[model samples]
Target: MARLAPSFGHLVFILSLLQVSVVCQTPDNVNSLLTNLFANYNNKIRPVNDQSLPIVLDVSMFLFSVNAVDEVNEKLVTTGFLGLTWTDDLLQWDPTLQNEIFIIFLPQKDIWKPDLVLKNGFKKLTEMGGDFYFLSISNFGDVYWYPYEVFETRCSIDITYFPYDKQTCNVTFIVWSYSADEVIITKSSGGIDFYEYEENSVWTIVSTDSDIKKDSYESEITFTITLQRKPRYYVMNMILPVVCLGLLSLLVFIVPADAGEKMSYSVTVFLAFAVFLTIISAELPVNSESTSILSFYLVLQLMIGALVLIISSIQLRLHYRKSSRGMSKFFVAIVRIDQFLRCVKRYRLCCKKDVTTVENFDKNEEEQSTELEAAIEWSDVTNAIDFLCFWFLLLVNVGLTMFLFLYITGS
Candidate 1:
């Protein structure tokens, strides 16, 4: 009886297989199968949220040169989720021929007002960031393909940045390209479709888009970025300030090492460097992980500042070396008194005094150091300015050199 039962089950299975094959081979049967499959598939997928669909929007390359964005509603979405369209503009009135576009999507689920403070909410979309993917020209999926120098992202505790929250999350995606005149966004598809279990609404995505286009034929590279916010912060906070500080070093050459305030400028430069660092830090996200070119600049500037202080110390020591026992105390004491009016008065008859006494005093000091004032080479604090300035200038050039070097080599 047991063996018979097994044989019966096998016969039933074979019959089912035969029935399916026959149905599949027939036109009517095949239609029925397709209808059932589509019905079942759509049933499973239709109720899903936007996140469930990994595809973004399609980008249509239409114009040769453009820098603008047009917000499209859900109605604007094409019926079929398919390939993006590429359009070419033959009118060479402008230089490039591709439209610049940055398409962003906010999940529908992020539709709640955030207290934003202690206002616990779902982590920001980026916090949930996993893999980043894009379609390519060939195998083309590249973030670097864009022409812009910086990617703009805003971080705020405000709920308004989220589209669903009625507050739009600001996403600034910038591009800079000379070869492309205009670009159209036809399709943005492909990514993990995220679904919100609670709201069952659309997932939230915060995005910002922007563009800067420049045309220069003489330069080998027609496209160049003016803002340093991405790397621009480096210029405002580190590179520019460093360059400024370097230039300030010229004060060393212009201002005599004999100037009483020479040492003071070291402190001034140090504070300036410190202030610049603060600005750089302020511009970056306050987090544990160090990022951006500004960080490098911070380190560089701080090093430069430290270097300035060190050189200042060396100046003090150098001045100390040039001074003999009694003379050192006498000069120091004399400097402390009335701007050294006593010393200048005693020596002024040697040269024709003019309204620009300070300027002439420096000339005389240099001449005297070389000729008459052989005993007094230079003061420590006074000479510190030149040394500090010299080193600072060198560091600035090095920084610029490095910036240009890295920019060129992409190091």
Candidate 2:
């Protein structure tokens, strides 16, 4: 019994020792599992380095070129954000992330190579960055402009392997936004009464080869605008208003010279021109190297005003001369001078000899010494005014019409 008890006791001690060994072994296994889990997680997070990856990987970027042509002294220009020429899809902005960008200018091989560095240049861009590059002209204004874009990588690598990953990726393309065109002005084929010219526009690209692939992307542009009417200066100043002035002057024959309407008509004609003058001057340059057609018309209007003033003065002198016949010869000579200017040598005022321009009217039917005297001849003054007004007004209108036609037709 004692022997059996001791054996049983040994067995229990042995089982306890085995349990301790298992517990100790369990901690080591747990530690190993934890280390393996962490190591696998990190391996999945990072991609293979240069050894596994290659440098010659595919990338998204833009490619561009400039074109020149004969239709205009203009060029077609384009821009690419990334260094790629093609996009997987035609419709998309530059990829937010990209590998490269490039710009190419296709000038005519025959034409002279421009001194791009002197004015517009790509030097600043090469100085700026390797990836976000620029190759266009720059004014640079004055000081430094290109301290940031370009750089030389210090790390070295094999040339044969391309550094590309197999995961999903994107590529983008860029296009030109703006270009400058030239204008052409040449003589028209259709002959004109006077010399004239016409203007036209077009867009063009320049290249020596007949087939330019880049020009296919370019589109044509045309401009359309509105036209306005210009007013005539000569007729507005000299002719149309003269018809009314003549009508007003004719009233002198209908009413008495002593009545108020004659002086009013003369004054109205003068003031009407003053109003026209104010308006015309506002349109014309205040000072000019050569006088305008408007100025010529105004001078004629001034002469008409002077004639009216002369008639008014003569009439005033005649009225007082009815009481004092002292300067009768002088008044007669003045009447003859007026007659010649009016274009009717037989023109006269009342019993006076020939006179021109509306000299004066006969006594009114109500005021005449006799009703017969009221109907006395006033034909002298009327004839002179008719002849002069007809020719002067005709000249003014014809000149204005021709001027307007020539201006509008570009003659």
Candidate 3:
């Protein structure tokens, strides 16, 4: 029993020492080890033993979402997470002492990170991380880094097609201070994520592609974003109303010339066409090189409306002319044209009746003369002109509408 007592005491002492050793290596001790790890090393510069050995940085980007794209300012705003990983022998440590496979440190506080800039950006993302900086070191001398960024990039736009246009905008990242030989940049996998994108209200994402471009001294990652504009709103609001206004111009021929409102009605339709032109012009880019087909059609319709207004004015003057001014040479020529077209068949019938009256009513001439005057008055030239113009204007309207429709659809 006495020998067993000393052995038990020795066992208890060894167990107590083991417990103390385990408890002593707490988080504070880990921090102490980290302090020692950075003691002799300068984290401000690249952790390379030889200054001539170039730092090869493997960069990759993954898109999370697109926030907004401002057309007026020509900026593309996006949110994504990207990583920059490189090998640094100086940051490596033995993992056996701490029983940890890797250690994490804030790049801002503990290490030198690559300075990457957006070459075509309107507003650059700040380095002050929204979350923790991704600076991790493995026991095998590998350093992994990453940062979440929101970039507002500048892009040149092609507004020739306006609401129907497809645009290709680029997001490029370049090393700020390093030459190609000093720091090499390479892509990770298939650069960006395409399947996880959310829907956009005004634009649809058509396609996305990424490629690395290198010049003599510069290297960059250029991501091309292809977007198509949604055109339902423009077609419904702008195009349909203009077509309705064009159809309204045809009403001038329906209203009789003697109604006293024919000229005024045609002028009103002409003015309405002009107003729509102004409205559409205000919404689109004025400096665009390609003329909008809608604009061209509106101008053609305006010209047709103006011609109708002028023709109505002429018809009204002919209908209301004083008898003292009696058939001028111009009026005679128009009557001959109506005769050639067989539009004045009533005039021919009246002439035959007058000849019959002159022969048969030689005996009772006074009564025959009165009947002849009434027939002559009913067969006036203005009535023939009204009949001819109505059919002519109706044909013109139908032909133009058909032509314009086919042209627009085919184009």
Candidate 4:
């Protein structure tokens, strides 16, 4: 019995030693595990055992914020990180062999990463991610790479509505070197992750869409962000002021032709319209693909200002004409039309009958009527022109202002 007891103790001691040896075989530290894993790894090659099978890459965007939407440059600048995941067959390892470590982060430079590039970059086509970035790798060979970037992409600006415009911009990424047969990109289930997104002051994200476009040669993933401009700033600063100027321009006719300020006032308003147009042009891209309705409205107002200036000059010339010269039939007809319109507007039946009764008068009254009609002077002609122009232009300015506002806002 004593001999059997000694053998049993030795057997227990032997089992314990074996257990210690097994534990020693496992990696003691993360560095040692990485060294072993990468000793035979070749990052220059794709991490696939079967060269014929394509790498199914899942892609998603984690939008941070919209930095700017430059209308003049037709560019969209944004801050975001791309979430890319794929299986690297050569990177797999047994978790039990690495102190039960299921996941570890490695410098992105040391991995066989896909050569993803910005397909629609505003500057130039460049590679995604930086050397300082790290990639998360699991024991099952799954790799997760989050590459934060300040992406400036080409976005076609449609300023047809200007401040009230809604723009749809796309940020496209693709594997640059690999063909569609070798690298197939897919939009992840959680396509665009806006959980960490920050709001932009000038633009509000209305909607987002993501999809993978595969062609015969390569595959690309596109993230579409629809933005609506916050027009309060433009409405208060630009649009409203222009509208007021348009209404103010109509007042050129109201200024007395004898008032020395008539020409100067009309000229100043015309110049102001010119300055506003120049300011607006500087803000928009130099393209004729689509023009803003606001621009069109401004041009029309400028033309009206010019017409007012020309008519005012003519009125001044007539006001100073020799009083000995007889008035033309055209001027007489215009004066009569003006009186008739005013009488109709005031609902005065007596004033209406007085205009018609001149035609049916007796011989003595007819002669007096002729003398009265002959009393029309050049000053009367100028006043008649002013009255007609004022009402006509006021209606035009109001109608144009209402149409411009309604069209742009309702768009």
Q: Which of the numbered candidates is closest to the native, going by highest TM-score?
A: 4
TM-score of each: 0.32, 0.30, 0.69, 0.84
Please provide, for model 1 over 278-315, each residue's C-alpha lDDT reduced to its tens digit, 9 standing for 90 to 100. 75554443333223443555576567667766766666
Ranking by TM-score: 4, 3, 1, 2
**Which sequence of candidate numbers ranks them by lDDT, best first?**
4, 3, 1, 2
User: Candidate 2's C-alpha lDDT?
Assistant: 0.32
Residues 292-394, model 3: lDDT tens digits: 5556656777777777777777777766665623344454444445544652555442234221234453557556644433343222445545556656766
Per-residue CA lDDT of model 4 for 349-402, tens digit only, reads 424222334444455965754654666677777877988989999898899889
Worst 10 residues of 1 by lDDT: 111-120
Question: Every model's Cα RMSD, please?
Answer: 22.7, 27.2, 11.7, 9.7
- The whole-model lDDT of each prediction reads 0.35, 0.32, 0.67, 0.83
| Candidate that would win on lDDT | 4
- TM-score result, candidate 4: 0.84
lDDT measured at residue 127 in model 4 versus the true structure, 0 to 100 = 64
Model 2 lDDT at residue 72: 21
Runs off by more than 4 Å, candidate 2: 1-255, 324-327, 332-411
Off by over 4 Å in 1: 1-238, 286-290, 320-396, 399-401, 408-411
TM-score of 3: 0.69
